[model samples]
Target: MDGDNPRTPLLSIVQESYLPKTVSIALKCILVGLNIASIAIGVIFMNECPGQYLIPYYLIISGVACLLFLCMTCLPCVDEEQVTSVTLANLCAQGVLLLFLFAFFIAGNVWIYSLYHGPWNDPSSPEYCARVLYLYAFWIITLCHLCFLVLLCTYLCLLLGLYILKRSIFGSRSS
Candidate 1:
């Protein structure tokens, strides 16, 4: 009777998602939509100012990278409990891509923000980038950085709290 359900352990392990599967799928879909929007904005940015191309390229690269990241993570064979060669390769690929993207984002920031002080409405001027594209890209980059900071802080706090709890529980037991 105990051997009747071979998938019991697999099902239990797979069901341990922090968010429900439906919610996870929904979030992924939403992210995909956002990525598409970003790419479209990037195209507009390119069309607006051909000289300052870094931000537009940055937007397109980051958006496509995110889309690929989402697709890679959603593969059916990506079981956390069962670490296969494919999973290892996927993880390594993701890490390399993220590192490259992070560096690219920093470069984009330098290029975009350095020119943040100039012509808002003149295509005749050399420094003129479309106001809408520049502002949107600026806010998006700023918000991404802000979000990363928030998540990092939250993770650190959680880790510290868990460490303190473990120490207290163990100290009380020893006493």
Candidate 2:
């Protein structure tokens, strides 16, 4: 009603989280733990193998990137008004980083899978890679793929449910 201040959607924005705070915090903690474990595994792998392969390096770099992404997400959006440019920028940056990391992880998958049958624990063999290291790397990437598929399916289901609900509500009015 006031001419001086127009009521806008951006101005009325509230800092509401998409996930409950407890759930979000718990998920972040789990991701942080996994990333740290991956980094440690990579270091152990490098020390034990000391080969020219880039698998260990890939593990380490991905772990670090995930950690960095987590930190960026944790940053508080100072400006709550105007769709929060700071938050938007942070999200966009995170998205780009995620795409790059996904591609990087896929490359790692190829590298690891191609060498699946290579020599393990054979010091004398030129292709020697510790059994433990190879197995761990193999399983970790497998787990990542499994998790991605589960999440993708869940998201699609959620979208489908919303679409059905919208159709039922609006379709009744038009009939």
Candidate 3:
């Protein structure tokens, strides 16, 4: 209660709140190992066959994102700065993965629809217009994915900049 007593409970609270999950080292490592493996699979398939049957890709990528989101969300939220950085990083990464998934399914639907009917849908004729529509949907999806990645990169960079700021503040204060 007294100003003369510099050591206060609030200091401990702040540190505990602001510090990232420095605890749970072994469990964190395990979670991280699993995440790496999951991300590896997602990226491998995503890069290799962007146009193939995307069911597996969607499941894997979403699974990884959900796992990571769960883990981060579960962590103690004492360190506001660290939490903010992690959240921003998560959003950027998750947004790209999810948007890619969204675009894939939507475009696929459009492509299939177009290929069946071409410019005109006729019950009697083979729908060649379907292919044309598919191309349109696919390219549009592709463009959306590109833009998503760009935005993700920007947010990630901002998080990294925040990390640097936190480091400098600590370094100067300590010295």
Candidate 4:
């Protein structure tokens, strides 16, 4: 088998069944949808608080990445080499982005939570309600990011297994 075809020997059955492609497409769609939803929620509850811009900024980046992923997967002429390279690069970039998002969300959550114990402690106050909404949005965004991270990790593991198998079979021959 040619080195260009990363899925040939390792996951021939899966490739034939198109399972990887289907999962990739589904995950990308979910991510894009979640990003859009998060952006909408953020916009609807827009506030002038410091660091409030992060929510929409992250959503936009993730949404664009998901769109790019969809486009790459939809291209009919993508070779296995191109697929492998592009997927690896995309996963790496997304992993980093997700890490940043996770930290940002955690920080935002803490800040919002602190507001609850501060002057916005009154349940009837607008500031209190806004904090609650921000907290909810951050929680949902964190969960979405976590889901994407799990999907990315799983895909990476599968790719790594295939790479290791290819290396073992080829015995030191560079792809």
Whole-model lDDT, candidate 4? 0.57
Which candidate leads the pack in TM-score? 1
lDDT of 3 at 74: 54
Rate residue 54 of model 4 by lDDT: 50
TM-score for every candidate vs. truth? 0.75, 0.75, 0.31, 0.45
Using TM-score, rank the candidates from best to worst.
Answer: 1, 2, 4, 3
Query: In candidate 1, what are the lDDT values of residues 19-116, reduced to their tens digit?
Result: 87789989999889878888989887686754476778778888999899888777653566974333446667878888987888889888778767
Tens-digit lDDT track for model 4 on 12-127?
Answer: 43234356767876776776686677556556655533434454444444455555544544544366666433344554555676676557656655555555455453555544
State candidate 4's TM-score.
0.45
Cα RMSD to the true fold for all candidates? 5.6, 4.8, 14.8, 9.1
Q: Identify the superior model by lDDT, candidate 1 or candidate 4.
A: 1
Off by over 4 Å in 3: 1-131
Error of 1 at 110 (Å): 1.4
Clashing pairs for model 2 are none
Candidate with more favorable, higher TM-score: 1 or 3: 1
The candidate 2 region of ten consecutive residues with least summed lDDT is 3-12
